[model samples]
Target: MGTTRTIKNKHAANGSGIKGSKASKNGPVNDGVIKAKKNAGTRAPIPGSGVKGRPNLADILKKRKKRVYSEKELGLPQLNMVTPVGVQKPRGKKKGKVFVDDRESMATILAIVQAEKDGQIESKMIKARQMEEIREARRAEADKKESERKAKLEETKDSLRKKRKRPRAGGKTQDDDVNGFEAVKALAAEGTKAAKPKKKRVSFAAD
Candidate 1:
């Protein structure tokens, strides 16, 4: 039992020793040491040369200055420059001159004139229609008056014909009096003749 306890204590001390130690504090593992050896062989730095600073290309371009140009050389007007050529004098009369020259401008003027003409034509047509209406109204009134006058004349003519057909007492005809006073006179004569008794009575007066 004493030998067995000594063996068990030695085994527990070995397991704890490995568990408590840090991996990075100890030397590198076999795989990591092999990778470091391969990279050092292929990527070795040059002797006496460290990392270089970036180039200052902007300072090198600033040393070369751009060329300047004069106003006369560039065909531009200068402040002190004078007019060497004299001004041209005017010529001929200004009468009968046409200001607008292009076809487009002349077409615009013609359009305005045409519009005015069309407006005038429309106005004239409207006036003509109005005048026609007035004439028609007058003709209607004249026709109405003519009809009225004709009716009055016909009425007067009909009255005159009726008066002529009727017989007047002052201008009576023989036929009209035959049935009036003439008939009465004939009856009175017949009565008087019948009343006289043969007139022989006159001879008896001698007896």
Candidate 2:
């Protein structure tokens, strides 16, 4: 029993890394922690496995959301399948407005300011045409109003130039003058005429 105990302890029982001895707790090697490491070589790939050591990709795709694919979109290409070959992203392109480094010189800016001060900022023929049109419209409107006023003045002058009214044509003549009693009698007659309806006489002819 003493010799057997020495033989057991001779093989790195204190984790000193001796031969035929396993690593201990907190040792460099953990062979002692594994139980069935003996004859435990790397597992061979499953029969006819497309990807070694991994489950079938077709089974995974079947479990996912099903999608209909065309022959063109699902064709097998004669290129590297797993590793990417070249640039994946597309080339950069301009999106919207771009800035330019070209700037106006001081001489050009000064010339522009001077031209503006001279009231000739730039020869805008369009604006000149528009202003002419506005002037023409205003002139036409003024001419229309002036013609109407002139005709009205001419009509008034023609009316005033006519001969005076005759005294018999219901004017303020001596025949139209009346006393207070006559005026009252005329008003009473007018009131009676307005209040009564005129009767029509019906003549009967007998055979």
> Which candidate has the top score in lDDT?
1
Model 1 — which ten-residue stretch has the worst lDDT?
Answer: 59-68
Root-mean-square deviation of Cα positions for candidate 2 versus the true structure, in angstroms = 23.7
Model 2 gets an lDDT of 0.41
Q: Pairs clashing in candidate 1? A: none
* Per-model tally of clashing residue pairs: 0, 0
Model 2 per-residue lDDT tens digits across residues 137-176: 9999999999999999999776543312222134324323
lDDT, candidate 1, residue 60? Answer: 21
Model 2 stretches with alpha carbons more than 4 Å out: 1-41, 46-124, 165-207
Q: What is the lDDT of residue 45 in candidate 1?
A: 21
- TM-score of candidate 1 relative to the true fold: 0.35
Per-residue lDDT of candidate 1, residues 94-202 (tens digit): 7456788899999999999999999999999999999999999999999999999999999988876554333222323542454465434434453577555223222
Q: How does candidate 2 fare on TM-score? A: 0.24
Per TM-score, the best of the predicted structures is 1
Clashes counted in candidate 1 amount to 0
